[model samples]
Target: MRVLAFLDGTLGDPSQPYVRVDNTGVLRGDGIFETVLVVDGKPRELGPHLDRLAKSAAMLDLPEPDLELWEQAAQQVIDNWEGSSEIAVKLVATRGSEGDPDAEPFGYALGMEIDEKVKRARTEGIGVVTLDRGFGPDVAERAPWLLLGAKTLSYAVNLAALREAGRRGADDVIFTATDGSVLEGPTSTVLVAKGRTLYTPPPTVGILPGTTQRSVFRAAEAAGWTVKMEPVPGGELAMADGVFLASSVRKVTRVHTLDGVALADSTAVHAELCEAYEAQYA
Candidate 1:
């Protein structure tokens, strides 16, 4: 039950070829994208995702995204998605035909069912291994052209890290900065809980800001929990009361292990985190 819709209002089956053969997005990976979780029929945190998408476009020196058109297209795809109450929709904007110099920029939205394993991790939790990210926390500010915080279409390194995790018999990864600072997961943001407080690394340290994490923190604050953004050390994750990874599809997922070492069961703590995250939808 996958669906796709173009900005021009064309709706079609995603399996059918649509994008131009020489599209620069496919040839050079020159683009930006966002993954939005659609529950029931509403897209979760659509505004923040679109704002980040625009910020990514600015970082790449591309034209500003047509948010109105994209919103219409994304909603159209969501409306057509069948059989899944929980769907993951991707909105991709790219430089058009590489062979056509005068080609205008174009984009589309595609909707599909979320993977069963990702949903399972929401409850059963995931095991993670820490790997050095090969750069200090200040790299993003020092080297802005590297696009460190942008959600670009290129994710080869992130995908490779997941493969390495599999090789090491781990389910996922929590990347640490070269200076032993906790950065984020390949596809998620890291949050460590300590008693009645929660901490997450600031996005200024070179990670994409997590839309889901922001809402969770707000919900936590409303529930009388202290929330702070700081530079989290890798060791802090191991010693924290609970470690969670936040993402759109997975929401708040508990990190059950680190480097094959079993972490203490923090189910009660994570249950609160889940409730806070889910509060936005309510």
Candidate 2:
């Protein structure tokens, strides 16, 4: 995937050499970001993404982003980018270059790229495993610092977890609490099918509130399927009728296997949810 980035108000050409590096976001990973799906040149679930970004900024005590400026820049990027069928737009606001770790500034970047694999995963569910790494509930509650629920740029652990999951013959990994309750996936939200209801861990349970999951729940309700937000034990995850991961980029992906345990054929409900979601967005 070739990515195009807008640095401040300047557009850097792909053929150009030597892009300036800013230490604020590059060295310390001191920033918050939001990734939205760009379908037909329009962002999907933009409001939710922005809301989450604001929440994260507040958690970090970063300067609040001017939503009006962000919206304008996002629309400008979408207008300039070509082939918008299945594209990802990432909006990032960071503290500009500075030498002090305690200082903050107002600077941001806009990035756009086209990814087809994420779309494919939605149609065909992904294989996942349970990773033994994640912030414990107590630690997260006490000194979150920057890891609890904020989508900060410090994603080294997330990348490591994904690598470990791949080594275990899985496409993704879901983190479990110290007590073995399901938390969430590396970059997605975990949703399971229990009887005729769809269940996902609540935001209070330490998982990012997935915009796609929220939309799926609404669609499920319209389709006559009950949706509930509650805590799910990791052991009982295997007993679910079906398992799926939700994200803005991947949309909704059913999980055919969780830690080598194959879930039942959920193609029917999966299709129903996908269809409803697409229709609603369309």
C-alpha RMSD of each candidate structure in angstroms: 1.1, 2.4
Model 2 RMSD vs true structure = 2.4
Question: lDDT (0-100) at residue 112 of candidate 1?
Answer: 83
Question: Residue by residue across 105-141, what tens digits does model 1's lDDT show?
Answer: 8799989888999999989999999998898999999
All models: lDDT?
A: 0.90, 0.77
How close is every model to the real structure, measured as TM-score?
0.97, 0.90
Q: After aligning candidate 1 to the native by TM-score, how far in Å is the CA of 125 from where it should be?
A: 0.4
Best-performing candidate as measured by lDDT: 1
Clashes of each: 0, 0
